[model samples]
Target: MIRPDSFVPSARLAPSADALLFIFQEGRLLLREDGTLPQGHVEDFSVDLVNPLGMLDGRPVFGARLVGEVPTGFMLRPLRGVYGTLSEDLFGLAGYAMQIVEWDRTHRFCGACATPTVRSERETSKVCPNCGLTAYPRVAPVVMVLVTRGEGRDRELLLARGPHFAPGMYSALAGFVEPSETLEHACHREVREEVGVEITGLRYRFSQPWPFPHSLMIAFTAEYAGGDLALQPEEIEDAGWYRVGSLPTLPPPFSIARRLIETVAQGE
Candidate 1:
């Protein structure tokens, strides 16, 4: 697990040896053909496009944006595709870098006013000169619930596939937490809304930073309370209960959904 203490945020833009460069082009991460982070000084590549991410393991880390054309000796990969393959530490760092770059790119101008914004010298934020409004990185919270029913050999897990999911892949029910809603409330509401089923015995499991444009997925395990499966046509394409021994295609092992399902299937 990536701990908060692993990264120390700072505004200083100092380069050092062993520094990891997280370069992105139009949101895709830049990696060598071997699927490893390209290493070099900020000056070796393009310093003008680099942004100070923070310090990792006492080394200064940076995020860079490369627009148009693929540079030699490097290839752009979708951030999601590199999840399970990359080292856990590096993956966490890449996620952190991506979120910072996105926040900085989107907050170039103030929302309160039309004036341009400038980076804060003391913190990780953008400040509007005219209105004095500061913008920080936004992290949207999402709730994921793995709903199961029955017990022993007859126990079955309710898995649902969203319309956008690839092929027959089905996982837990998840949705973003609405404003003025508690995590627990969001869990219940999302399950009811997405699958038209009530869930009880909601137990908090764990959380993962899903940085496909920023989302903190808080996972949970719940018991099916009542109601029948009435899939939300707009969101869910198919949903069903499956016995432990027989299951369809699941999410990738890197995902929290897969972990949650494995926990229940393995009786862990």
Candidate 2:
């Protein structure tokens, strides 16, 4: 199993030189050559530099942009790529840039006094003109649970699939923790909301920084309490208990949800 701890980015040595190039098509990412970031070191007229994500094949690959059509750009690239490939790191950088661009696009007007906001020179931040409120890259925290039950032969973990997921996909129960709620509370709420099942005995398992537009995934293990499995109509399409010794297909290794489930199932 590919663990999240092993995933890497290459551009770490030259922090001061990388740039975030915006391939603007009336303001949307161009998608052709879907994975080649312009060879900045060899090319002149490089737009802007981004933080070095990491190196690819000993050649440093920085986050970059290319000229392309606007209308099709948004629909062309999927936010999360399913399998591993060289494009994976590039995709991460692209997604990170997209998040910054999206934040800037959406926060043009200040919320406090309704005045226009401006991009800050301080890097990856914005400032409101009227109230001086500063906004930085936002990262939301979410919790995922591997809820299990049964003393011996009956031990199982709860898995669920959402309507938005691809076919035959099953993943750990997850949800963003709401304001004023504890991590344990978030775990319980997500289970109830997604699978209509109750869970107890929550224990922290691990965490990963999932930078698909900034989310921190917190993984946990818990015990199943009494409740029937009922798919939440609006969110989930199916759910069930799978014996611990055997499992269904899981999310890719980059996801903490997959790591957490695997760790528990392996009796680690």
Q: How accurate locally, in lDDT, is each candidate?
A: 0.86, 0.64
lDDT of 2 by residue, 1-268 (tens): 1112233444243532333232322234434355433343313333332333444445444443332333332323344542343245554455555555555555678777778877665455668877888877677999988899876656788888878887788898888989999988888988888888788788998887665556778889999888988788887788888987778888877677787887888777
Each model's Cα RMSD? 1.8, 5.6
Model 1 misplacement above 4 A: 1-5, 46-49
Where does candidate 1 have its weakest 10-residue lDDT segment? 42-51
Q: lDDT: which candidate is best?
A: 1
For model 1, residues 31-90, the per-residue Cα lDDT tens digits are 998888877686677534467878877887888777667778888898888877688888
User: TM-score for all predictions?
Assistant: 0.94, 0.72
TM-score of 2: 0.72
Index of the highest-TM-score prediction: 1
Scored against the true structure, residue 45 in model 2 reaches a CA lDDT of 34
